[model samples]
Target chain A: MKKIVLSMVFMAIATLAMAQNATLPQNITIKALDGTSVQTSALQNDGKPMIISFWATWCKPCNRELNTIKEVYEEWQEETGVKLVAISIDDARSANRVKPHVDGNGWEYEVYLDQNQDFKRAMNVVNVPHTFVINGKGEIVWQHTSFVEGSEEELLEVVKKAAAETAE
Target chain B: MKTKQKHLPLLALLLATPFLGNAQGILGGHVTGNIQLDGQISHADSVIGAADVPEKLLMNARADILYTNGNFSAGLRFEAYQNPMLGFNSKYQGQGIANYFAAYNGDKLSVTMGNFYEQFGSGMILRAYEDRYLGVDNSLLGLNVTLRPIEGVTLKALAGKQRYYWEYGNGIVRGIDGEVNFNSIIKSMAESKFRLTMGAGFVSKYEPDQTISYTGNSAFRLKLPLNVGAGAIRADINYGNWSLQAEYAHKGQDPSIMNEFIYREGDALMLNATYSQKGFSANLQAKRVDNMSFKSVRTESGEMLYINYIPAITKQHTYAFLSMYPYATQTTGEMGLQADVMYKIKKETLLGGKYGTDIHLNGAIITGIDTNRIGGDGTLGYTSDWFKTGDLYYADASLEVAKKLSSKLKLTCTYGYQIFNPIVEGHEGNLHHNHILVGDLTWKIDKKNVLRFEAEWMGSDSKYDKNIDDKRCGDWIMGLVEYNFTSAWFVSVSDQYAYRDGVGNYYNISVGYNHGATRLQLGYGKQREGLLCIGGVCRQVPASNGLTFSLTTSF
Candidate 1:
């Protein structure tokens, strides 16, 4: 048991050390379906906490989690002032339908398009419904893959706690 | 909505970022952009819709740029399609900023004016979008609003016209959808071992479809904005290692070009269950749909015209032959089932060998739902309810085994059996028996170099032509060799020989280099026509002989 613990700590330290020196991931530039463009880096919710979610039209889990946030996102923002940028990773094949899919869902989100997967790959995303929360320092504070119905709310709670600590 | 406003203004007040400070203001506007390009050259004699599409050169490209600072942002996309690749909207042969919009984000409220994507309750009633590869873009031109008055509740409202090709959809669409998180509302559900979550939404669209019919007649003559509505509710709960989820949706009737005003009402049901432990896991999924084909313009083909998507619950495969005949979800009349299980032997055990042994099993079946016609020919007909089992469309069962021979060597093998009925997915009548086998061996000679070899064999029981055809049953064998230098550079060579049946033998050679933050790859191959999919959404890529290049980087 002692050896196992020592080896795990060593591995963790080594991996974290290797990952630490790595350059900070650059933010992505995406087009709003409406013809507007936004650089993910330029937006500064960093002082608080920011949630970046990757989603697409054909992905049900993506929609499910987004919809859940749609229900409580406003309240969470008001209380914790947390921000979320819902990034749509729909390729050219489904890009045109993006407008209607968003309109129909009636979701009030800061939506952007990663049409070419530049943003998707930049963040090492291999699956839809991937999410990242950054601190005010522009560092990835937390990240999760896949989503269940209630995961969004759980995510908000974590952000709220992080924001509270920042305030302290 | 709230994310953009609070941080931007706060950042300006705090003067936290030095880069944003410039001439007119301390917070400078941002510059952002993206581009997509697809080009194809082909040759075929005649084309029957898309089934026998002739070969031709085609290319599509689009780029977008946006500048923003403070609480404001705006951008545009430039598009170009010379011949419009296969399955693209025929009208989009031209090019330009097919979509654009502007917006403001705030704490309790937000507003946007321009073109965008929207959906309500699985997007059955209202959906606008684009899929460049499959040649479908249906952006909406309009205004949208998001409102949040309390915790655990959200509401969205929007009105717009669809973007067709370089234009807009021929209809006026407006919708409102809201969802509630039970845990957020109840509070008590928090901190419990058993977690439960639930939500519901409603969506609707209005389109003033052109007053015309198939036989040169005026249908609807209604000359009114076609109205379609839908509602959906979903539930998800998890306890320990087990989780289950389900969603139900329904959409009202609205006629457009695709179904020829075939009053095919829409509805869908999807369910999934999963269980997992230390080294074992199992999952099951089932989905059913009927007459739920909802689109702004019914006449549109390919993936662009879909009002909603039915996710295929089956496990996506990686082996070449096993993935050749991928099953695309049928939104009209289809029922499907899938099951998957995986297990790994504990290390240090006799059966685990030196490292461990891994086993995986997967099975999937898709079939059309039975239905009865309600009207005569050339008339708007109705179909029975969905969920009714009908003729089987396709089925595949597969198993995989992997073992570590020693500390530096490992091998994996897989086999699959498939039953494919073409008629169900709009193909001509014919059932097939497909058998596939795959083997892979990996060897690590030292820390700086590694080598791998792969082999595959596929056989079809009855691919021969019964008529006056000299073509015989087809069989294919493939071999691939890969060499890796350190962790940055790699080269691979592979060839697939269609020894007996098919018209063409394919060869592929690829070289790639990954430098942690960036990767570059180049390849030349004679690609066989097959279904290409990511996630649950899928589309078919045509047979092609060509060279390709790709580059990816992150700063």
Candidate 2:
């Protein structure tokens, strides 16, 4: 048990160091709302910042977070030229419900389906409502999991910081 | 000392990671993973039928590690279960590297070796996946390849054995799938509003023949097929705000225990249609499954080794009372339909008040496929017409309305009605009819503090019967309050009481803290025993009086 603990401690440090600079995984393909395959590499905002949120149709917290963000998404885009992509890990069972749910809520963010959670695994997202902010260089700058009623405010701050860093 | 020797190489590699990080110019890659630990301490509760646990504490833990460089990636998952949880399978009590895979993903060609998860269109014929909460992981261990020789076309092929607990199943499964997107390949169609994509998949399983004697006749042997196959075709079409998707699957004649060893074919069809715009949306779905239980092993049963998936067309309700009697898809033979509509009232209107009001209505009905038994065992089990319907299995309808009462407060109300047949759970009882009501109020006390309150009532016609031992029956009332503060910590308290014709009171209190990508949650509660389901798959969670905690982190 002690040796296992020692190895884990070292592994944590090594992983943290390697995690300093990370970007989205390449060559991963997911499905858009229109049933067309989309490459993750094509996710960009013309050198601007981007926000990626992992969600599911059945997750109440995820729905709340997305709904809250929908109210201010236009403003966020205008202020930072930031794009938000909502990825649904609803699997085949509820994959069909994502489009209708998103449209029902009248959300304009780009939506995709990670039916088998390949992208979710690649991104190392343990749970829904996990958000990541990417800079102009496609480098992940900030990340958070779970959301509260007012968590959107903190998310905007991170996007702004990332946008500002890209500006420099 | 021996354990240290075993991990010496791993330690050395970890010690050298810093130097490797310094060589970013050469490797230019990163490492990422997630860790989760869940522990439970439960004591016997005779009222709820919670059995005494010999092990004072049961824990399940897993760590996933991945290394990525350009188009190449590799990962492994180490899992440990000191003793399986109440709902989980005991076969998973040991610990090891449950999953590992190395892959090269390129623009046109992608290949993966070792263990991997894959799914065909709609997962009707092939779906190798995992759901930790459901304790269902059927990922295949073998080779998977995908090719995109031209734009708008994807081809995938895989061959492997299904993962059965710590060992692989005897059956070898192979499948190939292809999909084409018309809008991407044709220039004229690229800009058109009408879009179309079609996919087809074929899967086959091979297992060595096994001898089986006819019941009560030792001289007669039942001949089992050495190979069974299933195929599916799917299409997705979208025009303007209207969209439609459909998939049809068929399986060859294969005798299995789930179907009483009937030499009959199996088929399933699912169709979905939706129309939506900015403020309103409508969706309708229908599905029919007949003897479609396709498992890797002919004799294997109960939530594992399924090569095909038949999704339930029912709303996965969120409210505690509304989902008390959830529906699980019947793979042998069932038909169902669901309809959902959502509309948002304009703000400043009387019903909308200061903020817009959102209204959602959903309804679903499921029934057994009408069939006439022609013969049993070695012969065609039953015959059914496509349009005929049989006994009602489940039915539910719900309506929800959400409106903000003030800038700081929001309220939502839901009403649901359900009719469930106890036969689905292998029990014999009168149909249960329930009426449920739920009210939720969320108050944003401040920028970083929020308080939410929920109250629910369920009135059921079915009374609690000790013979059946189903805890979900009887009239029940529940209340919950949660407070989140400092944008990081939260506390929740809830209680459910069967005030009429019931035997138990379940209460729970939990506290949670989240920091960045890591979260720790602790709770003490009396849990009700029931089916914990995801999608349509379910596991029986035994009732327990316990303390539970989970910690998860990702880097």
Candidate 3:
């Protein structure tokens, strides 16, 4: 019991001291919505900032977050060269529903399926609605987990920050 | 014990390296991790059938840390289940570094040593994974290697022993898989309209021989096979809007407790087809399994040590009442089919508003295989007809409609019908029929405030029997209301009441706060006993009245 408490304290301190310098993961392969194999490292936005959102069809918060973002996606993109990439960790059983769900909602984001969750594991994603912002240099600048009613606005703020850094 | 002690310094160093690297402003390397802690305190309640808890407070906590530098990466997970929470196996007590792995990814080759999770060909033959909520962690401890020999060709080989709680299983597992994408392999096919991919895998397990006594003739003993093997082949083809995938797996005859020690060969077949357009989409899936309960240990039973995954072809419901009775995959001998369709009523149509309406329909059915029993021990046990389906095991049909009543409010209504046979759980009884209805409304009051309400009702013909003690058999009603404010805080209250032929009321209230990558939630509730399922894996959760707290953070 003492050792567990000590370890928790140590981890808390270490986490606080850590830096936010995450880079895009490489060499992991996932499937595109069209059923074609695509490498995570190969995803590029033509020197633009990007937002990656991890979601699943069964996750209500994920759907809520994405739908909220869809309402202001165009404005965010127009203001900054920011692109959103939605990744589905649906596995095989529910993987078939992703494309239709996205299309039916008129969401204009690139979608991919991580059936085996290789990319999710690599990114250290513990739960859905986890979002990451990548700058033009491919460095992960910001990330958040879970979503509230207006969390998309905060995401846009981070995207704008990444875009500003790229412009500088 | 001495060797383990000797590694204490190494463990300490691994834990401290990330902080030191960050302090030194290290370049080109990143450290990431997540932590989750769940704690519960409960008291015995006779009315709810909750058993007295010897441990008044139970907790489950885990921390996963990963360090990555270029193509080299490593990770470790520390898990502590201090008198594990209810519903989790009690075997998971104590704390340690449950999983650790180091890997190197090269241009065309990657190798991982230590603990790893993997799957092959839709997981019909092999799948090693972890679901913390389900208390399932089947990661293998050994080595895994993946090689991309040429463009579009990938091969993987692994040798390991499955993790059983804190110890490794008694059997050794080895597997190899290879896949080829014709479109990428052949230059001409790259631009073709059709895309094709094919794969094959072979998995084998080796365990020490064990003596088994026949059921009727207890004096006679039989020695089980030391080695069991399974092979699978799969293919995926796509042409424009149409796509199809299929997999077939066969396993050599082996005696196991799950199948009553039958020597029948195991086989499984799964097929899926899908078509989609801008406004319409449809999916169809069919699967059949015959004596395919492959496991690492012949005598081991339960949710762990599964060597293959039987795909569940039913719609996973999101509504409360719709999910009251979930179907468990019958791995022994079952045939199932599922179909799903989604269509959008375009804007300006009669049924469609300015924002359009979405409609979804799904149906699934599973039946036992037509089989004739033979002698049980030292025999094939049964003969099954490939084209015939026997008794109906389960069926579900559901329809849902979603519309934006206005810019601030969205409404979703669902109707579901289910027929379930108790035989799915190895119990024989009449089929239980249930009809459920749900209405959910979400209103966005403002940018930072949202309110949601949900109500569900389920009418069932099967009454709850005290002898059987299945709480899910009775008619029930549920209601929930949630309010979110300030974009970071939320509260919800819900209740479920069984009003007819059953006596139970479960009420719950929860509050949560989220900031950045951290979330904390607290709840006090009475939980009704039921089967909690994810994918096709089911776990029995006992009734309990408790106060629970959960905290999760990632960096």
What would the TM-scores of all predictions be?
0.69, 0.94, 0.93
**Model with the higher TM-score, candidate 1 or 3:** 3
Tens-place lDDT per residue, model 3, B139-195, is 999999999878788899999999988778999999999989999989999998799
Best-to-worst order by DockQ is: 2, 3, 1
CAPRI quality band, candidate 1: incorrect
The model with the greatest TM-score is 2
The reply for model 2, stretches above 4 Å from the true place, is: A1-19, B1-26, B529-543
In the range A30-138, model 2's lDDT, one tens digit per residue, is 9999999988998998889999999887776787788888878889999999999999998777889999899988889999999988999999987777889989999
CAPRI-style docking class of model 2 based on DockQ: acceptable
TM-score-wise, the better of 2 and 3 is 2
Residues B1-555 of candidate 2 have per-residue lDDT tens digits of 001134344444543443465455323667788998988899988776677889989888889887776777767777888887777888888887687777888999999887899999989899999887667889999999999988899999999999987778999999999999999999899999999999999999999988767664779878888899999999999999999999999999889888988988999999999999988999999999999999999889778899888888899887778877878889999999999999999898988778899999999999999999998888889999989998999999999999888878989899999999998887888999999999988899989889989999999998888888888888999998988885588888889999998777889887888888888877788876554221111223445689988788888
> Per-residue error at B193 for model 2, in Å?
0.7
Residue pairs clashing in model 2 are none
Question: For model 2, what is the error of residue A149's alpha carbon versus the real structure, in angstroms, after optimal superposition?
Answer: 0.7
Of 1 and 2, the candidate ahead on lDDT is 2
lDDT of 1: 0.60
lDDT of 1 by residue, B197-287 (tens): 5656666665555555445555534233367776777766667767666778887765555555565556788776777654576777787
